[model samples]
Target: MSSELPAFSWPTDPSLQPAIAPVPTERITPEWAWGGSTGLGMKVCIVDSGVDGDHRAIGGMLRGGAVVEETDDGVEVTEGTHSDLFGHGTACAGIIHSIAPDAEIYSARVLGKNLKGYGSTFVAGLQWALDNGMNVINVSMSTSKQDFAGILREVADQAYFSNRIIVAAANNTAVYSYPWLFSSVISVACHAEPDPFTFYYNPDPPVEFTAPGVDVDMAWAGGKRATGTGNSFAAPHIAGIIALILAKHPTLTPFQIKSVMYYTAKNVRTELAAAEEEKRDE
Candidate 1:
């Protein structure tokens, strides 16, 4: 007797067409278990000071992006200028690239040209990201304007429904900021972790995630690098991780991605355990 079993084959019929079955979304699990995905083919918009694509830390590559400008009439969108006005944008870009090296980074300059014309420029940059079909947007800057908060909330929600993940940095101080404080966007703050990839999830409101932001060595403009600390650096770490997740699992919705970030965080279990302990004591 043969030890091997014969495989079953489908019957061939000239009169019948082959039917393909579609897999259900809920039943599918992403391949993030294996852990080898770059942000290749993903468009990540850095809506801050522009990025210098030639920076060594960025690997001398970037997707061509638009620069928002303010004129006497109104905000205008222009192309062919992706140079970082200040070094802040470059620093953020370097962190994102360090994690998702192949992600298609784009610059949407909205700040630091003079900081005087930020309102319109900020709106224009975000609008550009939405209009251009960005997969992920990293917003390291936020406005404290309460009057514009409602509109910004709507904008963030629109991106959420569109599957465009926006990772925003919480305000360093106790003062409020738009977009980041909104429930739709992922809000990140600082932690003491020295590893660039290390991140934690907070159970608190407003600040949902904490990544390495204390005295981090980052890339700056003019092909230079520096050590800095703030919630600004923390936002990009989550953004980069998101880029990796989106690369491996492009089908994941914004909600699903947020869940992944929360559950896979290094400190989630610890945080939950501590909360449970406190509740038991109470």
Candidate 2:
């Protein structure tokens, strides 16, 4: 049996900027709602520059994965000795391991030594994750090109309906990006704060959660480490937590996962505080 693709938004009308918000209806939360779980056995795929499976920080944790190598024929995905070309993938994997130590980490290497890749490679990596049965995918990279937007959106929606979660990072700049902006995925950007466990759900659209991605220390290539900042780093933190959520619940749909994230965010109490103040006045 095959699954049907979810809805798509081409947005060629040019009537609005960044597309006029997704109307899923607004539902607010009063407090944190996630529980404790070790994230054991959850299949978490880091779809980035690939994971340095040999990195000490990841030590004996990788379940399995593949690397998208370029060939004259086109793109070839090879499954062996894949290590982080740059420090990005390892850093993301380290963050996830720190948060969810027991979650089985996998790598779908798409980026290269330059830490950048074309849209086709990005899409290919994601499709590999979906096909390989990854429960949660961490995509710290996105293609800003308008050409690949529709296809990426379709894939993201497919992941959503298929019970797979794709946590994506918004672009570092204000430029437009796909997969992250698509409503099907959990789009994230960096906030000024430093708490890895702290996340804020935007009551607005395009971007959803805001987590730690500033001046953060993380694992790097060649068993080294570094401190950096970007929405890219923030994404893994969410993915790690999602692994924990799945560990305990094990059957949460994408919609339900979003609800858990929104309510569990640190700033979730603002509206509740307002509601309480209203009651106090009466």
Candidate 3:
């Protein structure tokens, strides 16, 4: 059960540029018309470079134990380490935590020291997330090439069969990136401010949704701010949205959750129609 793939595009839209915004309380605040997401009691696994626990945006949101390892340099690094060296993972974790404040976060530091790593490390993290009972697994990484070894694909299938929801980042490039490229995971694209610029290079169901990513501002190391301009940032929003959805319907299977999200997405057809209209207008 998959949708046909769509063409891709990347445009310079001023309104789409990321700007300074609040700490993503819309997904959590009761005042929101969408209602607050009940991340309480649900545990989310954030598989990324790591998190800086002390960041104001993430303060008490950080939960779960650390998975640490020593780098070739002999430096010790911890999972949910609660500190960011490059700030990329922190920004991503902030988005997920902001939307699912009640949801406990389990950090899996697959990427270490600025996110330079091999595919095996990420695969290991994915397996770890499953074994530890992580209801939601957020993978904000991409592999340029698409290769499916028997065991890796089986692992993805096992997670799906076991009812674990995995969210992945669509590759920044026009080409598909794995595990987002893999049909088992939810692939997310970037949608930025004002004009709401969207980047959907892949047309398959894998590239299901889009969220704020462009010049979006988020917490960085040393109390600084960083702006990202890619789908990488957008993926967390989808992960966060999933957290909200799962909180409401705990019994939903991965397939059912994915279907409901697509069916209930705010103005999805309208947005796609509008995109086509704009293309015609151009």
- Choose the strongest candidate by lDDT: 2
Residue 43 alpha-carbon offset, candidate 2, angstroms:
0.5
152-193 per-residue lDDT for model 2 (tens digits):
998999999999999999999987788898888999998878
* TM-scores for every candidate against the unseen true structure: 0.83, 0.85, 0.73
Q: Which residue segments of model 3 deviate by more than 4 Å?
A: 1-34, 68-82, 145-149, 194-206, 269-282
- Which digits, one per residue and each the tens of the lDDT, describe model 3 over residues 1-282? 644435554335757655433333223222231256557667787777777777787766777645545457543434444555567777887877777778777777767676776666667777878888988888888666445345556777888999988888878887755777667878788765523222233344658777778887777666677876887888877777778778876777898766656544555545656886999998
Candidate 2: residue 39 lDDT (0-100): 83
State residue 58's C-alpha deviation in candidate 1, in Å. Answer: 0.5
For residue 103, model 1's alpha carbon misses the true position, in angstroms, by 0.5
